[model samples]
Target chain A: MRETDFIGGFAKGLKVIEAFDEAKPRLTISDVSKETGLDRATARRCLLTLAELGYAAYDGKFFQLTPKILRLGHAYLSATPLPRLVQPYLDQLSDKVGQSASASVLDGTEIVYVARAAQKRVMSINLMPGSRLPAYCASMGRVLLAALPEAEARAILEASDRRANTPFTKTDPDVLMEEFARVRRQGFAVIDQELEIGLCSIALPLENARGRVVAALNIGAPAAHAAAGEMVERYLPAMREVQAALRQVLA
Target chain B: MRETDFIGGFAKGLKVIEAFDEAKPRLTISDVSKETGLDRATARRCLLTLAELGYAAYDGKFFQLTPKILRLGHAYLSATPLPRLVQPYLDQLSDKVGQSASASVLDGTEIVYVARAAQKRVMSINLMPGSRLPAYCASMGRVLLAALPEAEARAILEASDRRANTPFTKTDPDVLMEEFARVRRQGFAVIDQELEIGLCSIALPLENARGRVVAALNIGAPAAHAAAGEMVERYLPAMREVQAALRQVLA
Candidate 1:
């Protein structure tokens, strides 16, 4: 990893793009500098390049991403086969269960949604493809971690900025470790109000044809209607059926 | 834009990322150099930077994007409001019509899909959010082009690499200009096997609260079952209901 081989300017540009989230859609040079910890001059150069490329729009004082930026994500979705492979299965599971179902791959300390089928909005925020959730708090996240080696999973947990999203959320590393063991033994996981209040989810590991755990599958429902304890009894059987079906197809 | 204001390395990195698509997911440094028109040394450096930053995976000789690259696209979806606002309408329209519904904004000479709802796969390739289609051939593209001034629409058409995708495609700028006028009067456009064989679509312009056309919405079906001419009688009534409903909320 030579320093010259790594383009620092390209890396800084990505940070500037990620700096604009739901809270801050439009950012000035100063705001970008403050959010991404890049120098104002550096941020300005990146923003200008993005604007010139049609990825970002510049309106005098503010810079925001245009829909053209979706082409960057489009490259991933089109080039990668994971999302397309799991989409139909997710749709089928969501239809049969009358709930939202998703498939996500473990990325560092977070789980990134690759495919989803929405029967309805179970979360206040829309969880579509490309959505990210903390591995320590989400049902799919925990199930993905349970498939990893104990030491490796522990490292990811240690690296994460752990926080309790709800009163029921677990922040302690030791408790999370025990939960991982339980998930490994039972072949699935269920959560209630751990990510957000009044939300319950059941999840299972999706193994590839090679028997490697490539992703996790989850079915979510509003806890007011379907209790978390009951989802294991109700949704787990159907989820496992998809899991087995996906294994025959996934590489 | 000033020369110093733009980051050349950052622009080159993005080009490297875009070089991979459904046809070619994995590439070596030499392949990328040729595909992206970058020199071999520069291509190697960009790929190395992507691998070091965890956005790409370098499996010995070949390089490919990891799911982490989705973060780039997620940043756009999470920050943009148009996709989130139109998604539910697309779902409702798809459910009512029993066909695929989508919303897109015209970007240069292409229409970038912002949201989609699929009752089933109508096209040979699945059309989802972030998918792109040439503005000259798609139903939504024609409606959006009709919204623009005639000169502007002509300029976009000239800029496109127009070709016949199907036997029914209209490539003559003269014929397309007249079609645009009809779309403006009728308030919608219909395409029959213009983009692909056995595919038909009907589309209308999506207006903002100010009555400015912000995007285009369409319902696509198989031409085998639903003739392009008959789609007006079957789907237009329901599509107008959603289009009018969307006007109050879109900004």
Candidate 2:
């Protein structure tokens, strides 16, 4: 990353917007300044600019992002073919397995969902296109990690806090390494009550035209509904079918 | 609108990202410069900054926005209550009407779709969240305009190019004024093949908790399947039901 090549102010402006989330839907100028580590003046200017452009709205004091900000995401979705191309397959997989199916790509230490189809709400968390989860604990995350170089996967794993999200979660680096090796050999990964109790998911890597794994496709269901054997028996074939079809289209 | 209040470089950077659409998904630095009206150096810096931040990717010659860019939209969707709150109602409306139902907000001279549910495809254009259509001709657009002050509505109408997209599109200002007046009184708007031939739609304004009209909810069907009278008789009631339900939630 060359410093001369970057526009620092533009990046700072985006950071200001990103500073707001579910927990903090509205913020003051000082709040934004503290969140983005920018001075009060810079944050105030960005907030006012966003408000003026209809991307953010201010009501007296607190500033909140407006729906107009969705245009940025819409631009990416409308222009990119991956989400649209993969949607029908996710829908089919979800319908076939009677669970929620999703596709995600590795983004740094997390996997960002790009496409999702739900048959029934299985998780407490509402998973949508922009939802993200730690790469160390999610089924899709391990599949994505397995696709990366061993050194890179280890680096990401080491960087992660690697906590026991649930009693079943494998937090030890050596154990995770063994699991990643198994996932690479088996061509898929299944997490049984790892990320959360009663939440299980099975995932397989989706390859691009060059046969390089670009994303992970997964089906998540309640553990009470589908155990590890049931997932392998019922969900695996459908996932493979979708993966094969995607490979041809991607090719 | 104030020059000092705005961060011009941030706006310019967003414009650079918006320049990539379905037609031109990839571009060189010069292409971006031409598309955004930014100088070559400015475009290069923005592109490089986006690339370094993982929001974009440059394969040497062509620069394209990456899936990571969707995070911005996700941030908005996660923080905003409108889209999520309105989705299930739109799904119910789509199921009942056996057509497509959508919610949109007026943005400048265009209406941007904020939520959508489709039962069948009726048009050549694939409508989704973030998709924009000219406000002068869309049924939802007319409904939104009808909710605004007469002076503001007329100013927007005057600012629009107001071209005839189809043979039935009303480009005359006087005729449109009469139509807007009718829509305001009737509490809804119906378009009979104004945007595209064979496409008919009925729309009603969706007011937030404050009783201010913030968006429009619409149901669209093919003319062969639903006439203007049928839209009023069938679709209008369903749209109103959704709108009423939404009002409670928004409140």
Candidate 3:
């Protein structure tokens, strides 16, 4: 492709930022090259450029994203209307559901947290507005995935190379497809310790007035506190309430 | 700047996004051009590009930011380490301070909220992770400004066309300089009814490993709740504790 015709270096830089996630927060130059399919030199240039721009930091051998990098995500959040509208509701949901709540939007192949509220002293990793997780394994990702067109969802599932991140993670592509079908039928999705060993999450879609899934909101807690039946019985009503509240404001 | 230099376009687009604040969330092309000095046609293009990228929405005549713009802020919050490290502490401070707490970083002439925790049913504006306010007027901004070198701080003061945002806003550069000096001596700042009518805020700098003030953390509340003695007697200790926690995690 012609250089200008393709997504430009700025886009590529953004993609490189995306390549770093919970599982791969720090990466070597060769790891980035292999992950992003860029030449090692290109990856190095990108890393150096990112460092110069105050987005990446080097600790002798490994490159890690810096807090300055949060500015990009901050820029998006400050300029967007969704997180502002959804956060208070998520906060209230956390109180009502007695668990942590989060809203994530699909960014390429991942689900990035746009808004989140957590109960104090939770077991899972602390996720913030800019945190990203694999879309194929999390409840929020599954909600967005189930909302996507079948072919597109299938493409992501296939390209994702679903890893059994935990024992509960659904790794088989066919199983994921079936799960998507079930989620679509139920209008929500749940993960039982799929993302982390003792963490569970349940998610529902946040659609605009047009009924397009613009984001996914979910609540997570330890598997003991968020048992599948208990989540369905207790949290589902609150989640639906948030979805309705969000629709009113977002619409 | 060359047309090939997308940097200028990017900068202009950022300005367009920045032009919208809590007070002005929607503007016409002419309004944006007048506000940003980019002319109508250029402003239109930027708005259109933003719309195409799902960062903005336009109703032919009036343009407003889209919820999708949250991704920009989300990108930063997820990648940045400082705010993530500071958040739980802010949550604790919210309870200790008996009001809302926010952590902000300087973005050009603005202070972007990277993290916030508000008491329930306190205010209408839900300050999420990416909200931006003019740095010159915010208590958080004063803490940051107080931390700057005298020459650089004076230069910014001279360049700033201090507008009277509220009856309580200090628009005089000389008075603001004295105020900055006082803040520097005391190592904190309290702003009363300046940014908004009922809102009062107190802020302190968050220094990095290099002892540079990289961010500011503040508590805000209605004037009635955050009286001067209460801030000194109750909130300061909590703020200091949060600052200590922030240094432990972020540094």
Which numbered prediction scores highest in DockQ against the true structure?
A: 1
lDDT of 1 by residue, A90-166 (tens): 88888898888999998999999888887756687777778899998899999999999999999999998889999
TM-score, structure 3 vs. true: 0.78
**Candidate 2 lDDT, B1-251, residue by residue in tens:** 46787888888888888888877788899999999899999999899989988899989999888877877877777777777788788877887777888989888778988777765568876676667898989999999888888899889999998999899999987788889999989999999999999999989999987898878999999999988878898877777778888888885
- After TM-score superposition, the amount by which residue B15's alpha carbon in candidate 3 deviates from its true location, in angstroms, is 6.4
Global lDDT of each candidate: 0.90, 0.85, 0.75
What's the true lDDT of residue A217 in model 1?
96
Estimate, for each residue in A131-217, the C-alpha lDDT of model 2 and write its tens digit: 789999999999999888889999999998788999999988889989999999999999999999999899999998789897899
- Least accurate 10 contiguous residues by lDDT in model 1 chain A: A119-128
TM-score ranking, best first: 1, 2, 3
lDDT over C-alpha atoms for residue B141 of model 2: 95
Q: Give the lDDT of residue B30 in candidate 2.
A: 97
Q: Estimate each model's TM-score.
A: 0.94, 0.88, 0.78
Of the two candidates 1 and 3, the one with more favorable DockQ, higher being better, is 1
Per-residue lDDT of model 1, residues B138-199, tens digit only: 99999999999999999999998889998999999989999999999999999999999999
iRMS, model 3 (angstroms): 5.5
Docking class for model 3 is incorrect
Which residue runs does candidate 2 get wrong by more than 4 Å?
A91-100, A160-171, A193-199, A222-225, B1-5, B91-100, B117-128, B159-173, B192-200, B221-228
Total clashes in model 3, counting residue pairs 3 or more apart in sequence or in different chains? 11
